[model samples]
Target: MIGNNISFLKGEGYDFCELKEYEYGEDVKNIDWVISAKMQKPYVKVFHAQKELNIKIVSFLNGSTYFGTKKFKQEVITQIASMLGFICVKQGDPFASYIANETCELCTKKSKKIFNVNFMAEQLFNYDVIGKNIDYEFITNDLFKKIHHKSIIFLIGDFFDIEKLDLKLLSKKHEIFAIIVRDKFEENPSELGNVNFNDPSTNQNFEGVLNSNTIKNYVNKVKENDHKLFSHLQDNAIRFVKIYTHEDATKKLIGLLK
Candidate 1:
């Protein structure tokens, strides 16, 4: 099934190349109205017969991703990243990755084979998940310098912390698809009598009673944060999807791609 899906995408070069006068055999849906109005003639977008599809996976391995009810967020990240890498390789595209936690590393060279994909996945799996502050500025700066071609970047992370400015800047250069990894516990907390919560990134501890009111507040806060993040991504025209640790990662990803 996966192989069939990859094969399907291989033949469909969806990238737009340039605007040209409409041809009779061309699809009318590709017409650019804004250009047509200005030129007073029907014009359609031309795309390369064989478009270059580059895939880059940015995996955030942080301490917060280690917390999950069923499977760890880190595990989900790895699964999704590996799946994307495989898809890229199957389509004969170059696959690169940026693995970061307290520090960041970029695999700039594109890998066009299954063995290369496996190697990248191994590096992602072996990376330690120590809670470290993410330097979005530094990461984006490095990415801009390294990747010159326009590519599709899958930003996979819990995304508890991110800078809007940094995200906006990166989106301008590449097509960004955000895969938000989340745990059920983080979204909906059970009403436990007394519990201690620890910050995975900072290791700060807080003691509080999880009553009805407290639970409501927690859920609301999560929703608020989610809204802000979603809004930012949407405003920037960045496609995004949420993957929960309790769900099947492969199914979710396949559905998203479809």
Candidate 2:
């Protein structure tokens, strides 16, 4: 609606409201079939919201996001971002995005436009994550400075390298929700005999043997990293959820909101 007569999707979600008798041409998906059967009449759900939220989705992308056992982490991140943006549009909320890596950052102009939603998703999905890394501390500080007005911000990423995150300052002005997109195999792995692997962040090749002991060590390190990350986020009262690449990102994100 902000630009051309170009059409985009809507009705992805809405705030809950009391149900009423179903009407013709209404979406049957909204019908509470159980309630309708009990009352012996067709009834439909209703949703209402008086306040609009200013929403921002910040994608912390790096080379690690390019891999997934089932569906790539980048794809899951795109799905989550697109769903969140569409929900914002449906609920009449202004939306913006920040797609960043170690070297570059792209911040979109804030608007309640469907084009922005589509464009943001496209950018995230097609983004090249090769030979790149993410600096959580720098990203957090930058966000704190740029996003002035109070808003709801969702940060999505594969938090493999969060040695230290300075989110305390950013959480003061905005309600922060962190979505840690990961692959199941990253945590639980099946050992492949001696093989060569390339470091995604650095693009450096190395030879190593993936044995049970190595897998155990790697998983333990990942667990320790996550423990520290969770502790920091909890200390700041920032709610977070982990979405595996193989899982339904949209459903999980919606559940997090609920």
Choose the strongest candidate by TM-score. Answer: 2
Model 1 agreement with the true structure over 1-258: per-residue lDDT tens digits = 122222223223454557889978888888899999999999987654454577888888877876888988988898899899888877777778888665568743577778877777777776667666566667777777777888888989988756432577778989898899999888987888898888777788989888999989878878877888898899999888899998988888887687
lDDT of 2: 0.83
Best lDDT among the predictions, by candidate number: 2
Candidate 1: regions farther than 4 A off = 1-47, 163-165
Local accuracy by lDDT, each model: 0.78, 0.83
Q: Per-prediction count of colliding residue pairs?
A: 0, 0
Candidate 2: regions farther than 4 A off: 1-51
- What is the per-residue lDDT of model 2 for residues 36-122, given as tens digits with 9 covering 90 to 100? 999999998876534457798989779898889999989998889889889888777888899877643655678888999889988
